[model samples]
Target: MHVPDGFIDAPTSLAAGAVAAAAVAVSLRGARRELDERTAPLAGLVAAFIFAVQMLNFPVAAGTSGHLLGGALAAILVGPYTGVLCVSVVLLMQGILFADGGLTALGVNITDMAVVTTVVSYAVFRGLVKVLPRRRRSVTVASFVAALVSVPAAAVAFTLIYAVGGTTDVSIGKVATAMVGVHVLIGIGEAAITGLTVGAVVAVRPDLVYGARDLRQRLKLRVNGELIDAPAPAAAPVAARTSRRALWISGLVTSLVLAGFVSFYASSSPDGLEKVAADQGIDKRTEKHASADSPLADYGVRDIADARLSGGLAGVIGVGATAVAGTGVFWAVRRRRTGDVSPTAVENV
Candidate 1:
């Protein structure tokens, strides 16, 4: 959820900011290992796709709504570290460009939405994928379960953060109960979206999926009295698969269509966090966003009276900007990985 300003006090917010910064720093380093020709390109598209799906907030309860948090989907498609960065990028774009999340509370939002969700979901996904049958279906199953659990995990994380720095004097127990309860419903939506998206990608190109990598039961051959692991595939086919330009183009187009048009039908209700905040008096101390005056504030362009066109255009802009920003960040990380290799090092024949 996008935490607005004044929800958390200065000290706690600063602490959370430090935590978010550290998490991003660590993820940047970890992504170096995860990013490659295949993943590096798709990582940006994943971010954009996440940004698009988040716009389609589905009804979760009587008044509350939910959207794809993207941590599980991204981690399954790309990698955990990159997943965190993807959500972080979306949050940044929303806060600064759309005025959806508060600028001052950016750290709190990132910690709650980006770091916690990615860590918890990816951990669950990895654990499950290891134990389950090593198949595409198993990967999808793990995605659903991981995403289902992650939404409530994020809610719990927010409650913990609020318990420490909530501006209002609401009962912490009540807040926790309400937060977790509503988000549990939201988690179902998250799970469905994650499962479908991950399944689709894994079906088309398992090679592009980071979580599916090495997930296939390694082949074995009977040789002389022993079963030995099969040799790795030739480099040429592998290289060909890595250049997933078609998949990349398809993903980008899908993102554009989702954000540009499909978002218009999304439920126009308070999301899980907003509903909980309003019900729990968490917004009593809420302050106006600094970017509220921006042209693209509130996911609409200034002076564009046509709500559909304005919001659609803003969504397109957001998707484009996020894709570019995310791509740049990941590309640099990939380059950093290559740069670390000494020029004099010999390549394995």
Candidate 2:
């Protein structure tokens, strides 16, 4: 959930900011290992896709809705470190460009949404992948379960944060009850989305899916009453066409549909956190976003009379911008990694 300003005190926000900064720093370093030629470009698309889908909040309860946190989906499709970066990029974009999440509370949102969700989901996913049958189905199953748990985990994290630095004197029990309750319903949606998306990617390009990489066990066959491993499939030649044009185009189209068109049909009610805050009096101390005056504030362009057209245009712009920014960052990271590994650079150093 997007935590607005004034929900947490200044000192707590600063502390969370330090934590978020440290996490982002660590992720940047770890992402060096995760980013490669094949995945570097896809990582950006994943971030933009997450940003767009999050705009489509689904109904969870009578007055509460929830959106994709994207941690599990990112971690399964990309890698944990890169997943954190993907989500952080989306949060940063939303705060500065869309005025959706508060700038002052950026650290809190990053910590709860980006760091906690990615770490928890990836840990659970890895653990499941270790124990379950090593198959594509297991990867999908793990993605589903990991996503299901990450939402409540984030809710618990927020509850704890509120308990420590809550601006209002709401009952912790009530906050936890409401937060966990509605988020659990939201987690179901998250699980389904994560499963379906991960399954689709694993089907088309299992090579691109980080979580399913090791699941590609060699085929086995019985010959002359003895079991023998079958020969590996011919590896796609490095020179073979390696174009993601189709995937990127399809992903952008899907993002546009979800954010521009489908979002209109999404629940008009507040999301899980917003509903809890309103119900528990947490909103009593909430502050406005720092970028509230931005042209794209509230996901609409300034002076746009047609709600549908304005929202759709904003969605398309956001998707394109996010993809470009994310791809640029990932490509830079990949380039740096390549340079570091280059023989000339290694020798020069």
Candidate 3:
């Protein structure tokens, strides 16, 4: 949920800003370990895909809607640290470019949506993967449960933050009940999206999925009435490896289609947080976005009256910008890891 300005007081916002900054700093360091050769590339794609899916808000209740939070999906597809950066990038882009989330409340949104969701989902996902059957299905199952819990966890986090700094004098208990209750429905939708997306990626390129690394069951073979593990396949030639270029291109194209075209059909209702805020009077002091005058404010171009074309163009731009920004961050993290691993660097002369 994108928290607008004036919802939280200045002191609380500043405190949250410090917390967000610290969380991002820690993630940047941890991402070096997560963004290796294989995962670095997928991390960018995960960000782009999350941006696309988030555009498609599905109906959750009569007036409330939900969208992909992307923490669980990203953590399952890439890694937890990188996943936090991924969602943070999307939130940043939305705040600066689309003017959806408020600039002043950026820290609140990042802390609740990016940090809390990623940390909670990944922790639960890893725990479940440890106890559940070590299979591809287990990864998907863990993703579902992780995503399901993460939404409510985020809601709870926001409720607590509001209790401390809410501008209005609303009942904290009522606000918590309303927020958690609506988000629980939203969590089901989150679970399905996370499960399906993680399943699809794991099926296609289990090698690309970081969370599935330990779930690779060895292929069993019957050798003279005895069970034996099959030998691992040799690495493909460079030419054979180049064939995956098409897959990457296809994935980018699909992201564009989802964001640029499919997003037009998404529900037009307010999301879980917006609905709850309106119902609970938490939004009574909400302020307009500082960037509301931007050309691309609210995911539409300035003068393009055609709703479809304006929205589509905005979506395309969002996907392109998010992919580039995410790739740059991940590439930098990967390179830093390489530099740290060098002999001279490690030895410190």
Candidate 4:
């Protein structure tokens, strides 16, 4: 949920900002360990896809809707550190370009949406992966469950932040109940989307899914009288033709179509956060975003009256901007890391 300005006091917001900054710093270093020449660009595509899918908010309750937080999905498809970067990039783009989240509240949004969700969901996912059957399906199952838990976890995080610096005198108990209750429903939608997307990718090329990377199923054969696990075959090097280019292209196309067109049919109701803010009087102290006057404010271009053309253009522009910004950041990180590891960087599958 995008937290607008003034929802939290300056002190708490600043503290959250510091926390967000630290998390991003840590992620930048950790990402180097996860991304190589091969997976670095895919991370950018993942960010753009998250930006696009977030536009298609699905109905969750009578008046509330929810969108893909994308933390678990990113962590499962990419890696946890890179997943944090993906959501952070999307948040930064939305705040500065789309005027969706407030610039002053950027830290609060990132800490709650990006950091909390990624850390919680990835931990849960890895824990489940460790216990569940090590199969491609199990990875998808873990993705779903992890996504389901992450949404409520973020809600709780926001509630705690609000309790610390809430501008209004609303009952904290009521707020917590309402926030957790609605988000639980929203988490179902998150789970479904995460599961389906992860399943599709794992089905196509399990190698591309980071969570399923270790799922190299072994062969079983009869040994004279009884069946036994066959000796594992030697790992074959990936051919030059085997790359993420096809998957990246497919993901980008899907993102374009969803944001450019399907988003038109998405529920117009306020999302979980907005609905809770309005209902719980959290919006009483809400301040306008600084970029409210931007041409692309409210996901529309200035003086473009055609709803379809203006909104679609904005969506396309958002996807493009996020893709470019994300790619540049990741490429630089990869290059620096490559330089450092040139003498030791291992690129084998």
Candidate 5:
């Protein structure tokens, strides 16, 4: 959920900001190991896809709606560290450009939505994949479960954060119950979307899926009275490598379609957090967003007047900006990884 300003006090918000900063810093370092030729390119696309899917909010309850959080989906497609960065990028873009999330509360949103969800879901996914049958289907199953659990986990995280710094005097127990209950329904939707997306990619090109790497069951060979692991095959030709350009183009097109047009049909009800906040009086002290005056504020272009066209253009712009920003960040991370290796080292190899 996108926490708005004044929901949390200054001290707690600043503390959360520190935590968010630290998490991002750690993720940047870890991403160096996760992003390579194949994954590096896909990482940006994954961020854009998440940004698009999040616009299509589905109805969860009478007055509450939910959308894809994208932590599990991103983690399954890319990696945990990169997944954090992806969701963070989307949150940052929404806060600064769309005025959806408050700028002052950026840290709170990033901590609850980006860091918590990615950490919890990826941990669950890794754990399940280890115990379950090592198959492509298993990866999808794990993704579904991981996403399902991550939504509520994020809700719990928010509840705790609110308990510590909530501006209102609402009952913490009631808030927790309401938040968790609605989010559980939201989690089901998250699970389905994450599972289907991860499944589709794994089926098409498992090699491109960071989490699916080394998923094949190692072969065993009978050797002189012993069963030994078979030798790995030689690397394929550069020409044989599937071009990610096609997948990237397809994903970008799908993102544009979803955000540009499909988003119009999304439910109009308040999202899980918004509904809960209104019900629990959490917004009693909520302040206006600093970016509320931006041309693209509230997901509409200024002076467009046409609801469809305004929102559509805004969505398209959001997708484009997020893609460009995310691609730039990931490319820098990838380049840094390359720069760490000296020319002599590459020549030696």
Candidate 6:
């Protein structure tokens, strides 16, 4: 959920800002180990895809809706560190460009939505995969369960943050109950979307899925009545041609379609957090976004007569901007890391 400005007190916001900064710093370092020749480019596509899917808010309850948090989905497709960065990139873009999230409360949103969800979901996913059968289907199953849990975890995190710095005099107990209740329904939707997406990717090219990378069946060779491990086969030529370029183009196109077209049919109901805030009196002190007057504010172009055209153009612009920004950040990280791991650096090490 995107926490708006004035929901949290200044001191608490600053503290959360420090925490968010530290998390981003750590993720940047860790992403160096995650990104490589094949995965670095997909990282950008993952961010853009998350941004697009987030635009399509599905109805969760009679008057509430929820969208893809994308933490688990990104982590399963890429890696956890990069997944955090991916969601963070989407949050930053939405805040500054679309005024979807508040600028002053950026840290709070990142901590609650990006950091907490990624950390919790990835941990749960890895743990489940370890115990479950090491198969492609198992990866999909674990992804569904992990995504199901992450939404409530983020809801709880926000509740705690509000308990500490909530501007209104609301009952924390009631707030927590309502927040968790609605988000639990939202989590089911999250699980379905995540499972299907991960399954699709794993089916097309299991190699591209970082979370499923370790899911390999050890072949046994009956050598002289003794079973031993068989040597790994070389990469097939056809499989070698299955690069990220095709996947990247396909993902980008899918993102464009979802944001530019399908988003128009998305439920207009308030999302889980917005509904909870309104019901719990948590929105009593909510402040207006600083960029509320921006041309692209509220995901619509300024002075565009047609609602469909204006919103569509804004969505397209957002997808493009987020993709470029994410690509730039990831590319820089990859380049810097590659330079460090060159022959000279290896010798020095």
lDDT of 2 by residue, 1-349 (tens): 9999999999999999999999998998888888776788899999999998998889888878899999999988989999999999999999999998778889999999999999999999999999999888899999999999999999999999999998999899999999999999999999999999999888777878999989677688999999898864445554333435567678878987877777767778899999999888999987778899989998888899998888887887788888888999889887887777875543332
Give candidate 1 misplaced runs (Cα > 4 Å). Answer: 217-243, 343-349
How would you encode candidate 6's per-residue C-alpha lDDT over 203-290 as one tens digit per residue? 8888889999897567999999999988654444664556556778899999998889889889999999999999888999989999
**Per-prediction count of colliding residue pairs?**
0, 0, 0, 0, 0, 0
Q: lDDT value for candidate 1? A: 0.90
Residue 344 error, candidate 2, Å:
9.6
**Model 6 segments beyond 4 Å from truth?**
217-239, 343-349
Deviation (Å) of 57 in candidate 4: 1.0
Q: What are the per-residue Cα lDDT tens digits for candidate 5 across 1-349?
A: 8899999999999999999999999999999888876678789989999999999999999978999999988887889999999999999999999998888889999999999999999999999999998899999999999999999999999999999999999999999999999999999999999999999988887878877886866789999999988865555455536456777889999999999999999999999999999998899999999999999998999999999999889999999999999999999998897899875553332
Clashing pairs in 4: none
lDDT of 4 by residue, 1-349 (tens): 9999989999999999999999999999998888866678888999999999999999988988999999999888889999999999999999999999888899999999999999999999999999999888899899999999999999999999999999999999989999999999999999999999999989887866778877976678988888887863344346622546778888899989888888888899999989989988989988888999999999888999999988888999999999999999999888888777654334431
Location of the lowest summed lDDT over 10 successive residues in candidate 4: 232-241
Task: Kindly list the per-residue Cα lDDT of model 3 for residues 1-349, writing each as its tens digit.
Answer: 8899999998889999999999999999988877765577678878888999999999988988999888888877888888889999999989999998888888999999999999999999999999998789999999999999999999999999999998999999998998899889989999999999889878877777889989677799999999998865555567535644555677789899999999999999999999988888889898888898989999988899999999999999999999999999999988887887885443331
Give the runs in model 2 whose Cα sits over 4 Å from its true position: 217-243, 343-349
At residue 242, give the lDDT of candidate 5.
48
Per-residue CA lDDT of model 1 for 1-349, tens digit only, reads 8899999999999999999999999999999888975688899999999999999999988987888888888888899999999999999998998998888899999998999999999999989988998789999999999999999999999999999998999999998999899999999999999999999988988878888997656789999989998875545474456447778988899999999999999999999889989998999999999999999998888999999999899899999999999999999998888888763431211
Residue 245, candidate 5: Cα error in Å is 1.6
Say which prediction, candidate 1 or candidate 2, comes out ahead on lDDT: 1
Model 3 lDDT-worst window of ten: 340-349
Off by over 4 Å in 3: 217-240, 343-349
Please give each candidate's TM-score.
0.94, 0.92, 0.92, 0.92, 0.93, 0.93
lDDT of 6: 0.91
